[model samples]
Target: MNELVLPNDTNALNNLMGGRLLHWMDIAASISAQKHCNRIAATASVDNVSFKQPIKLGDVVTIKAKVSRTFHSSLEVRLVVWTENISTGAKAKSNEAFYTFVSLDENGKVMRIPELIPETEEEMQLFDGALRRRQLRLILAGKMKPDDATELKALFFPEI
Candidate 1:
């Protein structure tokens, strides 16, 4: 997704507001998920979004998102945010985020999705990283107990 920065998105300090940036990120993420699933997908969660740079007004914002990992009924989407200064045309990395999306059927229940096909080594690496990140998020959110965490660690990080 690409957007031209406007004055309305700026705050009193003339910097872009975090809320607006997040809203855009969500939109882009959802679109990417839908494109991957080829079906209706809902935003399940967002984890560990960090803004590394400040975006000022008149900076062109570009968001790139892709499916990082897929589970039985969910997928993880990783997004990278970038900004380009209109005057200087210099591009800078702004932020990155990981989001979970759950696919739904006509009745709005969780549905199974096709198996992910990773064509490149980088895609395989992304899948591994996203799985690790998802497990970390689950542990932090209390979704995984200590035993469960230990089991996952054994499965994914035995070398550690």
Candidate 2:
């Protein structure tokens, strides 16, 4: 997804507003999730988002998103945002985020989706780390006990 950072998308400092950027990222991540499952997906959660660089008004912002991993009914989408200078045609990464989406049926019930088979080395790394990240998220949300996070526990206590 590509967006022009117009005045409406910027704050008083003439940089893109964080909220507006988040909205754009959600749309982009949702599109990737929907395309993967071929079903309507609802955002379940969004990880912390940090802007690495200020995107000024008139800059072109490009967002690239892909499914990092999939659980039974939910998938994680990784998104990278870049800002381009129109005149110089230079582009630099500005932000990155992870979004979780749950596929839904017409009745709005959660539906199972196909799994992701990561082929590349980068993909394999992300796929392997997804479980630890998910466990941490669940633990932080109070949905799972820290002791139950086997993958995460191993990181801190390798003997166990």
Candidate 3:
């Protein structure tokens, strides 16, 4: 997904507003999740998003997204945002985030999603790390017991 940072999308400093960038990321991530599942998907959660650099007005923003992992009815989509200067053609990474989406049927009920098959080494690494991230998210959300996060526990207590 590509977007032009117009005047309305910027803040007082003439830089793209964080909320506007987040809206674009959500669209890009939702599309990736829907494409992978071939069904309507709703955003379940968004991981922390930190802006590394400011994107000025008239800059072109490109968002690349891919499904990193899939569970029973949810999938994690990784989004990378880059900003390019239209005149100089200079490009720099602006933001990166992970969004979780759940597939839904026409009745708005959650539906099963297809499994993700990681082929490359990097993909395999991301696939492996997704579980630990998910566990941490669940614990933070109070949906899972901290003691039950075996993968996360191993990171802090290697002997256990």
Q: What TM value does model 2 have?
A: 0.97
Candidate 1 residue 73 C-alpha distance from true site, Å: 0.4
In model 2, the runs with Cα more than 4 Å from the true position are none
Clashing pairs in 2: none
The order of the candidates by TM-score, greatest first, is 3, 2, 1
Candidate 3 regions with alpha-carbon error over 4 angstroms: none
lDDT of 3 by residue, 1-160 (tens): 9999999999999999999999999999999999999989999999999989999999999999999999999999999999999999999999999999999999999999998999999889989899999999899899999999999999999999
Q: Candidate 1: TM-score?
A: 0.91
Q: Where does candidate 3 clash, by residue pair?
A: none
Please tell me which model should have the higher TM-score, number 1 or number 2: 2
For residues 50-154, write the lDDT of model 1, one tens digit per residue: 778789988999999889889888899889999999899899999998999999978898888667888799889988777767777788888877566654677
Looking at model 1, report the run of 10 residues with the lowest lDDT sum: 145-154
**Tens digits of per-residue lDDT for model 2 on 26-95?**
9999999999999999999999898898999999999999999999999999999999999999989999
Angstrom error of the Cα, residue 35, model 3: value is 0.6
lDDT of each: 0.86, 0.95, 0.95
TM-score of each: 0.91, 0.97, 0.98
Error of 2 at 141 (Å): 1.0
